[model samples]
Target: MIRAYHQPSAVEEALALVARGAVPVAGATGLYTGRSRREAELVDLTGLGLDTIGIHDDRIEIGATVSLQQLAMASSLPGMEGARLRRCCRHVASRPLRNMITAAGNVAHSVYWADLPVALLALDASLEVRRVGASPALVPIADATHGGKHAWDGGLITRIVVPRRAGTLSFGYERFTRTATDYSLSTACVTLRVDGSSARDVRFVVGAVSARPTRLVPVEAALEGSALSDDAISRALAALDRELPIAPNYRAPAEYRRELTQVLARRALETARTWAARENP
Candidate 1:
């Protein structure tokens, strides 16, 4: 059934409408494909000026309505971080879909196959959320996306803030799919800093095999202080099964997905190690 459509020009007006049960629409990609046939009022957020990408000295703030294509082409993001994010963004569907999918919408309505959130989790990004009758809050990507808790909770995500790291920082991303635009079978993203011969601040995230992107804490611990040697990588791989418990999916069996995750994760880590050596040396 068709219903009324309202375009709010301000964040506060949008939040108020959302609180009153008006379905918020950004890119409308998910809304169109969604199976919800019930009648609903739509509140469009495109006019709220939430599409700017600001690059600062210590952090990069991405507005919620920014398109994936815009993010991929942003010239301000430099070094390995920029390359990593661009690669992840390019892997999502196709150029047309990327033009229509908003960053906040992808993260907020995250599916198992979502790719950007994996990279964001590895980067330790945070979301600036605005709610009715409350001050805006910054929510960490891990807390906002994982643990079955909705970060917005009827509120709106205004911006996504990613902290910039200084010196010898490297990142790696990997995703598997039958076709270029097909849903991912497995995905992995890694980021770390190299201090001389040892690795520091290691963050390894796995996606497409679970409900949400998950950080492999034990695996990170195994590689954190090591030199990313063969032995260290082996130990980290051994911790993978325990840290990442894959759930069954119709696209693939649980065992298959687990094995695929191991392969993708290994490739991502190896890529990161190579980049670290190249950048640090």
Candidate 2:
């Protein structure tokens, strides 16, 4: 199908075009692989200068068009924050695809196999979205993904904001795949701070096995006030059966995915615990 393509240099112009039914695209990677073949007008968003990454005392701001590869190689990010982002981004597709995949596009597409959202969920990230006639809103990752496409119906995500925690934090991420570039079968990400000998501010997230990345509140609760001992980790793993939701996939059976998720989650937690102990000692 043939159609008009427009590259707007201003956010207002892009928003106006989107309001008029044009589909906005940064990398356009999802559009190529997307199932829908309907003819459509395309609005290019890369011209709007949404490609910079800024580090601030309170938060890190990533523009919508920032590539995963750019994030993986960013030198401004420090400590555990840099480590977590690099680890997750490096696991994303191959190098070439990572260069063409934008963070906003990845989150807005909201595919089950997406890895960035799982790490974002664990990091308590938020999105800044803009619409034609309304003030820009900062939406939490959890709420932004809660209603799927409906939450982003009329707005374009302009940037992502990750708040910096005050104290020392440890992070762990794990994913399982059939090949180096294959879509993930299951993924787990955890971030926690150790206070004395107990865990605090624990955020445990699991992805790919469900329709959307989900925070394991029950499992987080199990670890929140307890030492990350073997017994406590076992109890958290037991909570997975009740909290983790499985979606059917042709790549793997449901039972196999469930067990894989449990194992990956346990490993990620252990990794975080190890880091916490080393850093807190």
Candidate 3:
């Protein structure tokens, strides 16, 4: 049996309640497990009415309680960064799931092969973290946690801020899994800034192959300022092969994951280059 439920109207009050025993819920998307037990104190963040989206200075701030559907269904955004990330949101779980899943909840309890973190990482998104008494601070998407996980301790995620420069990035992702809803067996997010045929900067991230999604910096370094020729692709792939050491999984071996990650990274770069050409031309 659940003990109490509170729906505060203010962010601070909500934080106070959340700092107590209550767990904040935006859409109740992950609240149940087909008749499983429920948390004792449920903090209903929906009533806080934190849902809003807009550009502030150079970052787009997205409320934590905002639904995935709301983000995906928005007609106009100033840039492709939000739109591209929203496209990934549309592919998450299903339409109904998107309608209910909250951005805060999704990242707070990110599981294997989750969508938001992968895309957020690519966009260089930052999190607006608020606590009961402390003023909110922005943490980079890559370092949003205490011990390298997304747990906010006693803090609440008010919104996610994606920097405007994030839009300048071109990206692609690949998921090798059984079904659309099934968590990715392995997933990759590739982003790069290109000028004509030259790579200005690059980042490659792979999910479900480690304790957390990891950035392939060596792969990025290898591709930086390099033209997407056969030799460049080969070198990037080789760099990934040397840098990424995958752990064994029940479904596949470590060697297999390393191979898959390398292949996926190459393919993602190829696709991202194609996307850049279309977007830039």
Top-lDDT structure, candidate number = 2
lDDT of each: 0.86, 0.87, 0.76
Of 2 and 3, the candidate ahead on lDDT is: 2
Task: Evaluate residue 31 in candidate 1 and report its C-alpha lDDT on the 0 to 100 scale.
Answer: 74
Worst 10 residues of 1 by lDDT: 31-40
Model 3 lDDT, residue 227, Cα = 70
List where candidate 2 sits over 4 angstroms from the true fold: 35-37
Give lDDT tens digits, candidate 3, residues 153-199. Answer: 57789888987774345777877766777666677778777687677
Q: What overall lDDT, based on C-alpha atoms, would model 1 receive against the true structure?
A: 0.86
Poorly placed runs, candidate 3 (over 4 Å): 32-38, 148-151, 166-168, 245-248, 251-255
TM-score, prediction 3 = 0.89
For candidate 3, the clash count comes to 0
lDDT by residue for model 2 over 125-200, one digit each (tens)? 9999899989989999888854446455666999999888878789879999999999999998989877888889
Highest-TM-score candidate: 2
List, residue by residue over 151-234, the lDDT tens digit for candidate 1.
886889999998988878887788999998898999988899899989999999998888888888999999998999989988
TM-score for model 2?
A: 0.96
RMSD of each: 1.6, 1.4, 2.7
